[model samples]
Target: MLSSYNNNKVIYSGTGRRKTSIARVKLIPGSGKLIINGLPGESYLQFSPNYLRISCAPLNILGLHKEYDIYVKTQGGGLTGQADAIRLGLAKALCSVNPENRITLKSEGLLRRDARIKERKKYGLRKARKAPQYSKR
Candidate 1:
């Protein structure tokens, strides 16, 4: 849907963001391999099994988990954000393959980008909106 596609090109790609994490995803017809950056999906998401689940949820939702390979490069934010970004990216790439999937993806809430982000700490405040506790004299 982002253009730059051709009959010779067998890859569909999409960009996704969550919090501070940004993921670039490419979907290729292959044997369900998920490679992130330079690491295998599991190795890349070693902290928790949830990350792997999150990354593959979209494909699983559509029962296409074994039909395509997911290639992703993600940066910024924590692991959760990266996982979620990957999920969103995967959903988009799937959409490129079949626009009909959009409704199901949307119904499953995969295509929506999570927008929650950490608020910046202000110069005079202890944190984004928190201030030092006042002690009355």
Candidate 2:
């Protein structure tokens, strides 16, 4: 997590990961706009309200949804994982903005990273755990 000033404007940044997804988030003081990977957040998320809500959960929890703009660069994984990663990153940035926010974010479990990832496939297995059908005739 880091916060820096650009042209006298403050920017708070944080990184988050979920599954195979990684999101780099920045919080800028402005109207509540969300831009991801140079695209509008809504369009990037395919206009799914669930994704929008998940990505902005932290700000909504803090009643600062309209206070800061969210900018993110995310890659890998599906939309669900990306959305969660963004949420965590945003929460971290908010904490940098106000350390006290950690208490609130933590209580809501927003600061915790989801560690579950895809299981590796073993030799002779069809998938991570599924094996080919056996014929004992």
Best by lDDT: 2
**Per-residue accuracy of model 1 over 4-58 as CA lDDT, tens digit each:** 5446558889889999999999988879999999889998899577888899999
Best by TM-score: 2
Give the clash count for each candidate: 0, 0
Global lDDT scores for all candidate models: 0.88, 0.95
lDDT of each residue in 1-137, candidate 2, tens digit only: 56789788899999999999999999999999999999999999999999999999999999999999899999999999999999999999999999999999999999998999999999999999999999999
Models 1 onward score TM values of 0.92, 0.97
* List of clashing residue pairs for candidate 1: none
Off by over 4 Å in 2: none
